[model samples]
Target: MSKPLFAILLGLSATGALAQTVPPPQIQVTATGIAKTSPDRVTVAYQVRGEGTTSDEATAKARDSAKAIRTGAEGLLRGDMELHASDFDIAPVRSRECNRDGYGQAQLSTGPCAILGYVVTMPVSIDTPRIADAGTLAGLIGRLGGLQVGVRGYWLSDDRPARQQAMRTALASAKAQAQLIAEGSGARLGRLLRVDDGTNRDMAIVVTGARARVTPPPPPPPAAPPIQIDLSPAPIRTNVNVTVVYAIDQ
Candidate 1:
């Protein structure tokens, strides 16, 4: 080969060798951490429902039921306790004699499929910072004509502290995993280069066997004894995910 050709070949070989010897700039590890804690807040969900021959009548009945529930809940609310109405829906009620298709959609049959009435429903919730009052709230709301009254779940009013702790734990777990990987590959873990995190979110715990019994309404008599309910809920679990990048030292 000529001198110029030989020099070019030698330069290409050196470049390839250098590229092969260089290591990746960083190593990345993803980890998830979980923290379990007792709930600071208890939530009860109930619905006020009324059915009447006309829409206006149904709405009025629902309104009355809501007023009664509010009045009854007022005495139970302590500091940091709240009552909220989340949604309201009005739907037509049809006779039970209506025919149904395979999809469960109602079909007009030769028989009467006329609209029987209208039903109005409003979903309400009681959120209290005191966890012990969940059963009491459920009981009171049930007596106030609140249908489907039950403990919805247990939650944390403020999840910041739990999220922070979870993130720290996740970061530590990532570092440990990164170290293992680095050592296996004949490298050492270095400074943290970057972090991608899942933001703060609450994971509510579902309470089972905490439902309250429904009593026929007109509001219970004042002489009636208070209902006793026992509620045992599991701890809320918060999970945090993090992806961390660390510079690799060789």
Candidate 2:
């Protein structure tokens, strides 16, 4: 071969050898960690509904009832107890009547439709750390006329600590998994190239039980003890996912 051709061939062989000896890029591993904790707060929602012939009367009645409830709740407030009035709304109540023909068979006829009354509703929300008072509060609201009580599931007031702990665990898991993979492939795990927080955009999992609807029942027999309600909430879970990149040393 000529000198230039031989030089070119030699240069190509050297480049191929250099490429063959170079190590591959770092390995990336994704892992998830979860942490569970019990709820630390309880929230109860109440709605006061008033019905009257006129909208003004209905609104006044509802407002008065809501004010009374708020006053009572203020007295019940203790450490970490809070009361919030959410909404006040007024809407028309509708009623329909059926028209019958002389044969008594139902005929397609337009019946006299009119507004029966006006209904006003006031919504109130209460948050407290006292889980044991759920039963008493529910019963009290039931006894109060023109009030409907809705009990929401328990929740964690603060989840930052849990999330941080889960993130740590997820990172550790990713490192361990990467190490195992490296060892299996006859390589050693090197420095971390990158760590991506995959949980920042994901929402935490909050486990809640089915809501219970309770209306005041007839008075129990004198011999029967008063009823108690227990609303045990499920544990709240925080999950963290991480994508970790680590150098592989051969």
TM-score of each: 0.69, 0.71
Per-residue lDDT of 1-250 in model 1, one digit per residue for the tens?
Answer: 6999999999999999999999767888999988888898888899999889999999999999988777666555533457788788998776665644326775653355677789999998888776776897789888879999999999987777787778779999999999999998998889999888855344454456866644323433333544766687898888889999999887
Candidate closest to the true structure, highest lDDT: 1
Instruction: State how far residue 167 of model 1 sits from its true place (Å).
Output: 1.2
Give lDDT tens digits, candidate 2, residues 89-122: 8876554443222344533423443566799887
| Clashes (N, CA, C under 3 Å) per candidate | 0, 0
Q: Deviation in angstroms for 150 in model 2?
A: 2.6
Query: Which parts of model 2 have CA positions greater than 4 angstroms off?
Result: 1-23, 98-114, 146-148, 199-228
| Model 1 spans with C-alpha error above 4 angstroms | 1-26, 90-118, 183-186, 198-225
Best by TM-score: 2
lDDT of each: 0.80, 0.73
Instruction: State the displacement of the C-alpha of residue 80, model 2, in Å, after optimal TM-score superposition.
Output: 3.9
Cα lDDT, model 1, residue 215 = 33
